[model samples]
Target chain A: MLSKTIKTILTISAVTFFLSACSTTSTPDSATGSSTDGSSGTSGSSATTDGSGKNSVNDGVVAPTATVFYFDFDSSVLRTDSRALLDAHAAALKASPRSVRLEGHADERGTREYNIALGERRAQAVRAYLVSRGVTSPIEVVSYGEESPAVDASNEYAWQQNRRVEIK
Target chain B: MKKVMKFSIQVIVASFLFVSALSHAELTISITKGVDNPIVIGIVPFNYTGGGPLSENVAAIVSDDLERSGQFGPIAPENMLSYPSLPQDVVFRDWRLLGSEYLVIGDISPTASGYQLVYSLFDVVSQKTILFNQPIVVARDGLRDMAHHVSDKVYEAITGIRGAFSTEIIYVEHQKKARNYRLMRADMDGARPKVLVTSKQPLLSPSWSPDGQSVAYVSFESGRPAIYIQNLATGQREKMTNFKGLNSAPSWSPDGKKLALVLSKDGNPEIYTLDIATKRFTRVTKHFGIDTEPRWTADGKGIIFTSNRGGKPQIYSVVLADGYPQRLTFEGDYNARAQLTPDGKSIIMVHRRNKVFHIATQELATGTVRILTTETDLDESPSIAPNGASLIYATKRNGKGILASVSLDAGSKFALPSTSGDVREPSWSPYF
Candidate 1:
């Protein structure tokens, strides 16, 4: 049984998942906040706070776009919306020589070691997309698997929040 | 169908949660807390002379060791009629009247460079000394080890099976405060947890070699997960495998010449065996679905692994000659991380029934699956004791990770918990 805080966080995450899942190009300005922040939530909340705001494209540098990308269960194939998000990130990397690390993670289900492979594939897929886009900035990938999660709840919404790749 | 039982355990947070020396807050297992059809016994407090602060008591440690095995029920000191340090002082009638089937007595004395442990095990029924004057020498700081060795000898003399008390266990603790993940080793009684490795990222799936000289585990220290074999004594390590995708779940073969591992380097995850000497690799399973958690059968003829080729994850074994796997589990919709017992008679894995994940055993001959745990949200990673009498696994208690044990037959359960923080990924070490 999930605590009240986790249940509420999952409900909010489910709403956010569906919203982001439907959008084509989730602009960073519009997609900046999700109630499931890293500290209370499982994902990279503290990492995003340190990596964002000043570098966001809408800060008059370029077009603001989403950094974190979500995928379907057990599938590392980048989603259509994630492609658009990655394109913007690739553009940001192309404009500057700044390096970005792709942090990968998976839901807390199945065997941990296998989920590690899944997390690696997810982040490597994002790295492949950025590197293939001719972005000169160095890109790195690290898979946390189900270790550092975004949603503490055990439901599907929470799992979806956990199975994501954060571009840092 | 997954039933969720909600239960809470009081989480006592210790200030020194993370420390360099594992003794900072050793795991204290309450062996006398749970009751079963336990053998009633009495262990007299060990006699000591010229003590330079003996770190542990031999007789008390032996009692705790036997009691924790879930096979022995030790009588409290208050219940004992007399305290005896030798077999001459121990009266059979006195122990018989106290309802103790066996008795233990020991003496410890500090020497110039070490301590001497003299222990004895007696049969209360026949009033005969089973083990007498078992002498052990321990250099100054090795009193705990001497006690465990005595525990080992007494246990074997009475039970006929070699005791695993002197053995060690390797487990991982993933937390926020420390290096995020720590690979640790401790005594079977949950004492002296020494951290072997620490990682900034996640570390999982720690497997020990047959000789207990080294440990091979998956670490993300190089940024991504890769298998590394580290010498336990020298602290020297070598990256065994650093493939492109997945290099995890490394299990050493019984002979120690080969290692069966899970890798996704070729498409999806598959079981592969790596020759330790030649640096050769042999693919064991050919499957489209997720195939992982490959463990060597004790005989070394085949490898048993978990695969989802049949639509749901189940146990399968592949004979090394043909490299063809035969399904061994048909009872449940989900069964993963299957580990064969030392005798090769059964398989222990995380079996899900009605959606509740539990540690279960499947008799290979009968194909009969039996659930070992009753109430828990998620219980997984069932590592069988080297003696095959009990199992230690990671389970969630009050929303935190803790290690729990269960007797294979009696189903008695107990938790070996840390003072604070979550602990998981337990891998029992082989006998040294």
Candidate 2:
């Protein structure tokens, strides 16, 4: 019963988004860039552009994707692998002077408060790295804890994916 | 079996001594049994002086609190024959004739800067005053608390057991019909609920210190759950744990100097204790599985917690001094929230059997488990009353969380139905 209700709500949300898109103004540059970026594939477009080099926005200006940091269960320590991703996110934030939100999240296995704290730790870990990288973009950390999940499945893999800190 | 036999013999001997006390009003209850019928008592109208229109009527609130426990039935004021402030003035015969086993009479008058209450209890049949208390002043909007003090006096005098009526209860009440949750505290009978903290996310695992002055609970206020301790009287709070991993399931040390909690700050969730004075944390357990719900022994010598290290969530005792952990529950598939009874001989916990959660008491020495909750549903967080005879816990009814209490012996039971919204994580306070 709960699943059915959620499905209905999601369907309505999708319909609303589609209807609003029809009347919304679209920039011609973004429409062309989206198709070009799609053909190049998401993973292949990492040019590692230095601030000095300006890639042609008309060729394929990919929408900046968020960097996510994953932690060990019930732990706040940033893993070794997450360092690289955090560095990349920090570099991007430095290139773009605008502020970014660090969203903290946790898996569904533990208690709520525990997850909340874990989520905050994850966001703080990413923020600390960004600060070290000279990325001064205003960082605002918010923990979704276990309330918001990256995956809906109940399996271990899904839980691991859910327990993450996303730089948005 | 041998312990039961010895307990029965002890109960008989106690009863004999009670009866031999002659004119002395003595109550001898069986150790393993409780009176199915609540004790009937009358709280006569208290004599008041010059009209200032008091802030509250303590006697009425006391009467309602006792009645709600389902342990005492207070007679209506209209049924009383006479009001007496002192023991010598009470007409015991009149109460006995009215089918009242106990009678309470008191007077409220203006004191230094506040009001003073002088109350006494009389055992109807013995014609003797069971208890007499000196006048107490209403310190500061503390009349409701004074009522609980009166409740303790009457309960102790009648049941021969200390009363938890003076204690408070911590629970989570939903706002806007479960859309939001707030941590709250109230008198044990569920009166004067005051919200301590609130958030849109869920909150859980509220634990009270042995002194009953502070509470440690988990809140998702920061978008992630974190453990926080708040002083009930001052409303002052401090965040105890917000480690990167899980920081939850806090149980205060008996001395109130530390809190035994579960934290995955190091790795997977494990048991750890935080020194309140030094703000230092010491990991107590190292395991690959989940270790949560830590509780301290009355002596503070060891800790009990739920862990899946032994393949399932079972109760385990960890020695604080030596750091040696021993499994405590072998009879149940799942057991959590181990609360030591006041006597410290048995533990009351929620045990899962046949896929239903029930409150169960297990003797530490004999490993004999007695199921206390028999209804068909989820019953968790068993917190024993200060008296150790009854306990209050949270359970599901009509798809909404509510608080229900049961006498350990199954003699009497009552439900504290919430008028606000869903209530959960009920932590019974210790006697103040």
Candidate 3:
């Protein structure tokens, strides 16, 4: 009975000690994560969401955002303005372990299967950019093809709105 | 086996009619456009020898079918001088004077088992019976189908081509709720509809089994795309594939033993064939560019698929012997969702011209691409009729997606007029 009591006391002490060490390490990491993400997110929202999107075109000062990214018709190349946002998202992910899901969509123009593949390529392009920037978060990608459009009309504005990748 | 009684008695009909009685909506067909020279036809009202109720007007349905094809103009009931029930009574001179090049007459008789339909086709100008008395018997519930068969026979006899009237169609319609879809099957004329499957996600690319007993479609019900094959008669379905990535664009082989579909499980969209019985897979495409929408050749020797490897989407065929895909379409910047014509000498695909997508057919021999539709902003999913006489496709009209059909040789156009929401993905079933 005495040995059992001692063993239980030893186990509890060990658990408490390890938990304290873990919290000590996690506090700094979480602080760094929040600081980085807050700054990056602030800059991204300010640059991309602002109506003065034209000013950032030639300066290479803009970055892509996690909210939405647009691609050219039948093309998957990342735009110049998206680079900053991609880097910001990657930096934020590196600071923390939060995962993300990227949903790819396309306009209702081309063959549905082909559009699905196109949407996939667009998502992958964004994913590749983030990974190249050294992000380690678990990012899941899905292509909805032309099935789920952001706008359900047959116009250029609607098509442009439909062709997008939603980072969640 | 219940008998339906027709009530011409005024008092009984007036009494039972309340709040427009329960009704099953049959899709109405509207021939939005007409052909240059339509053959004039006279369809006399059918004589009924049975004492049961005729649920549908057989002769009138035949006339509607002829009129909707845009190849014939049926004489109106008021314009007909006389109504004939059999070929013996059809005076060819009378029809000739009425400017009808063709005359059709039929009678329905009840047998011990069910009903028998006897029909005849007469050539008014030649003053001869083109088709002798043909007999088709069916169950009480099969009267509409039997009438459609009669229409097929009459169409073939007059037009010198096999008719597609006795076929079915499978399509996907977006339900009232967003992202909800229903996969439905109905007659070619949009009669007798049956919903095969419903999903909260998207459903697309439905292909038919060679025997018309089952269908294969792609469903996103699992929050991811997968291929499923469902048996129509048994209501039994099998999840054919659910890989880590996309499993879509299921097309059955001509022999029904295998299915060719697109799967992105291998990191990118590519053409893969799954053997239904053995559960073996064979990869048909290996390319950095997207290769999808694979369809089997008529001879089953190879597959034709859409590929963007050449900077734009085009049709390419890869035979099993060579294992190398050769480009099949070069006439347009976009030609995808290609299906082979019955003869294997032509390919029908949705083509874009002047930024408007249209249904176009390409003769592989001459490499000639002819655009077939001109009305819709985005015409897609071109499925050829089994007889290869016409095709049905999904097209946008007035901000709504609906179905339209067009002839191959003639520029005749018609629509399956619906009164509801979006209807797309019209797949012409193999003849039953």
TM-score of each: 0.80, 0.67, 0.85
lDDT of each: 0.72, 0.67, 0.76
Q: Candidate 2's residue-wise lDDT over B1-432, tens digit each? A: 011222322333333233223211111111222234556677776767748666666776667556545566566655567777666678777787666777888878876666788888777767776667667778757777778888877777777787777787888777655578888888776767788888787677888888888999877777555889999889899988887656677888888899988776665578888998899989899886667778888899888887767766678898888988899899867777687888989999888788667888999999999997686356877788878878987776675567788888765556666767867678888777
lDDT of 1: 0.72
Q: Model 1: per-residue lDDT, tens digit, A13-105?
A: 434434344443323232225422222121122222212223443333342234567877766767544443455566556656587777888
lDDT per residue (tens digit) for residues A12-117 in model 3: 5334323322332222223222122222242535434322233433434334343666666888776444444554455555545478888888999977888888
- Which candidate number maximizes lDDT? 3
Tell me how far the alpha carbon of residue B234 in candidate 3 is from the true structure, in angstroms, after superposition: 1.2
After superposition, the stretches of candidate 1 with alpha carbons farther than 4 Å from their true spots are: A1-64, A69-103, A120-142, A152-157, B1-24, B31-33, B51-53
Question: What CA RMSD would you report for each candidate?
Answer: 8.9, 12.6, 13.5
Assess the local accuracy of residue B87 in candidate 3 as a C-alpha lDDT between 0 and 100. Answer: 74
Per-residue C-alpha lDDT of model 3 across residues B1-432, encoded as one tens digit per residue:
111122112212221121013214344465666655567778887899978668777776676666667677666655678988877687777777667788888889998878888888888877888877889999978877787888889998877877778899998888655656989888887778788988889999898898999999998898888899999999899999999667878998999999999888888889999999999999999998889999999878899999999999999999966789999999878999999999888999989877778899999999999988876658888899988888999887787778888888745777775555578888898988
lDDT of 1 by residue, B150-225 (tens): 7788778877878888888888887766646888898876788898987787778888899999999988787777
Question: Candidate 3 DockQ category?
Answer: acceptable
Off by over 4 Å in 3: A1-66, B1-26, B51-53
In order, the interface RMSDs are 2.4, 6.3, 1.0
- Could you report the DockQ of all the candidates, in the order they appear? 0.29, 0.06, 0.43
